[model samples]
Every structure is written in C-alpha cells, then in structure tokens.
Target: MASTSSGGTVELSGFFADLVRCETRLYNALNDRLRERHGIVTSQFEALRYLRDHPGSRVADLAAEFAIGIGATSKTIDRLEKQGWAARQPNPADRRSSLLALTDNGTQLVGAAEKTFTAEVAELIGGTLDSSSATAAAQALSKLRSVLERNQIGTPTG
Candidate 1:
C-alpha cells in the first residue's frame, strides 16, 4: 500500500472507511431485526429509549444527541406519537417548545426492545469473536467514539 504524507501507515484512511462500512452494515442488520420485531427502526428505537430514560426532553435535544437534524428528529417524534409510544406535553420551562415523553406503551416497547437489541448485538458480534476479543473490541470502539465525540467529528468537508 502507498504511504501517505501524514504518516507511514498507508491504511490510516482506509481504517476510517472500513469503520464506516462496518457501522453501516451493523445498523442495517440491527434496524432490520428491530423493524421485524417491533415495527420500529433503529433510530426510532434509540429515540424511544432516550426518551424513556430522559423524560421531558425535546425533539431538538434528541436530534443533537443522535447527531441528526432537528427536522428529522421532529418527524421521528411524530411517528412515535402516531404509534402511541410517545407524546409531547407543554413544556413548563419553555412555553415555545414542547417536551417529549414516553407513554406507558412506549415504555413497555422500549423495555422489550432493549433486551432483544442487546442480545442480538452480542450474538452478532460474539459469533465472530471470542468473549475476550469481543470485550477488547468494545473497549477499543468506546475509546474511538469518545475521541470523535469530544472532537465533534462528522462528515468530511473540503
């Protein structure tokens, strides 16, 4: 492999590319399973889980946490509302924006989804690596994620 000017590691750029591909595949597989079991995509499942844990958060807050646009987050909240899983209540702190909340049904769905999601992820990853390797992978990925989050990393712009 040809080396880059930044470093002798020719695979540095490819490392990020491969990571993106891996993430895409993982999310696709997880989303498919989630949709099949609960009629909810991974994004919706994430939003629901967040709201379940952090009640009174707005769509904007969720969008920021999920690294998505406010408009998209609002749409997600709309779908959750339609499914009777989430509801928007008038915010006491801010009369302009309503806070999102998980209904009883939504809470139950998230609880069920969490069990299946965690199991599926473990099985999917562990099917490839042994217990120790899986743990190592988790630790490494968490570190990488922390750095990226701290740096506010996103899509490349030139």
Candidate 2:
C-alpha cells in the first residue's frame, strides 16, 4: 500500500496501476521492435495501420480515435509525410480538415510490421497467460474501455 498526499492509502494491487504498467512494458517492447525492423516507432506503426484501415480519415478523426491532441496527431502525420509513408488530401466535406491516407510504401511496411507485431504479442502475452486468462483479461479491458468512453471520461469535452 502507498500513502497518497490526501491522507489516503492506495492498494498496490490496484487495477489502474497494473494496467498502466503492463501497457508501458508492452508499448516499449513493441516500439523497440518496430523501430528496429520497420524504421518506425510503435506510434507511427499504429497511425499507419489506422490510416491503412480508415483511408481518408482526418487529423481530428485520428486524434479522437487515439485519444491524443490534434497538434500531436498532426505532428505524427507530418513525420509520416516526411518519410513518404503518408499523404494528405483536401477533404471534400470539410475544407478546414484534410483527409489522411497511407502511401504504398506505408501500406507495405505496415503489412510486414503487422506480422511482427502479432508474433511479438503472441510471444510476450501468450507465453505468460493461458488462453482463458488472456481472453478474460481482454474482455475485462474492453468492458472498462467501453465504460470510460460511454462516460466521456478523458474525452475532450468530458
């Protein structure tokens, strides 16, 4: 247990702490591997993968989906553009927002990286947790995410 500044004690086994620690560890491993093999970090790979799946999505759309700021999303897009992995086109519906798309190079890179990503996840997660445990954890996390999203927690207007 840890004492909070507010004179309360927090359980060390809290789900939030565990979730964050797990996420950090997983993210760092994925980031390192992706950067080593794909020449892009995990964030870039994720953005590219999303763009591949949701072609012509706007920066704001990406920002909302990733729960990040528009400025940060734009910077990521800018980096992708610089690397010739992504491009922006004028949006037909919204003049102020540009549609984002992955380039052919990005498409190929992400496809390859997806394989690596899957393998790493399987090796890291599958190696530790059994199938049933993994499924349960995923389901629980999904439920939590739904609840948070539904409540507008951490949302821009929350």
Candidate 3:
C-alpha cells in the first residue's frame, strides 16, 4: 500500500504535488513530441544543443551537466555520431577524453527543431500571459531553478 506524506498541512503538499505532476507531464509531452517529430530524444537534443553552443565540450563535462552516468552519456554521443549529428575529436589537452561538437547537419537540425519547439510552447501559453508577464514568469522560473540547484534537489536527469 502507498501512503501519502504531506509536506505539512494542506498548503505545501498540494503545491508540491501539482508541481511534480506538471513536471512529469511536461517532460513526457516535450520528449515524445520532439522525438516523434525530429527523431531526436530530449536528452540527445540537449546534448546537441550544448555542443552546438559550446563547440568543444568533453563527455565527462556533459555527463556531469546531465547528471547521468558516463556510459549512458557515451551511448548518447555514439547515437548522435552514428546519425552524423555530432563528432568527437581528440582533445589537445587530454588524450583520454575527447571533445564533442555538433556537425553542420546537427546545428541545422537543432536550429529548426528549437524554433519548432519554441513556437509550440509559445502557442500553448501565449494567449494566457502578456509579454511582460511572460518575461517575469521566465525570470521567476530561472530563479526557482537556481534555488533548486543550490539546494541540490530536483536536479536534471539525463
């Protein structure tokens, strides 16, 4: 049997439950939609996006960023490489670790997919909030993310 443990009283548990439910729904929606439309999982998209922006990130650094095991991270990289979306080159500083970067095709794919994803999200909530309010919400969410990271809770999953 499952027992419910409220954080305390009525207020906290309701809020936390809603947040967790929303998180799961959002993850599934975004990941499934992106994968179906672009043939890229959310994790792979994140890795590619990071590589596209950073251009020389190592597997270890990426693993740390995604909070995933190295073998899993390497498998993502391998899939991306097999698809010609990314490539690995020997690091000048360290022979043991290689630097990963997005290829031209990868960059183009990410750009298109990102635009699609952004437009979809904007369409979903654009009518509910005005630009200023949306901006504020984004800022608030960013702060919340920082707080969660600082507290070492609700970390990103790879």
Highest TM-score: give the candidate number. Answer: 2
Alpha carbon RMSD to native, model 2: 4.9
Q: Would you list the rank order by lDDT, best first?
A: 2, 1, 3
Candidate 1 per-residue lDDT, tens place, 48-137, comes to 999988888998788768777778788899999999999999998989899999999999999999987998898788788898888877
Select the stronger candidate by TM-score from 1 and 3: 1
Candidate 1: global Cα-lDDT?
A: 0.86
Span of ten consecutive residues with least summed lDDT in model 1: 1-10
The superposed Cα distance between candidate 2 and the true structure at residue 35, in angstroms, equals 0.9
Better of 2 and 3 by TM-score: 2
Model with the higher lDDT, candidate 1 or 2: 2
Could you tally the backbone clashes for each prediction? 0, 0, 0
Query: What C-alpha lDDT do the candidate models reach, one value each?
Result: 0.86, 0.90, 0.80
For model 3, how does the per-residue alpha-carbon lDDT over 101-136 read when each residue is reduced to its tens digit?
A: 888999998997787678666765575679998897
Which portions of model 2 miss their true places by more than 4 Å? 1-13
Worst 10 residues of 3 by lDDT: 1-10
TM-score against truth, every candidate = 0.85, 0.90, 0.76
Per-residue accuracy of model 2 over 1-158 as CA lDDT, tens digit each: 55464637767568578889999999999999998888888999899999999988999888888888888999999999999999999999989889999899989999999999999999999999999999988997899889988887887641
Off by over 4 Å in 1: 1-10, 155-158
State, as a TM-score between 0 and 1, how close model 3 is to the true structure: 0.76
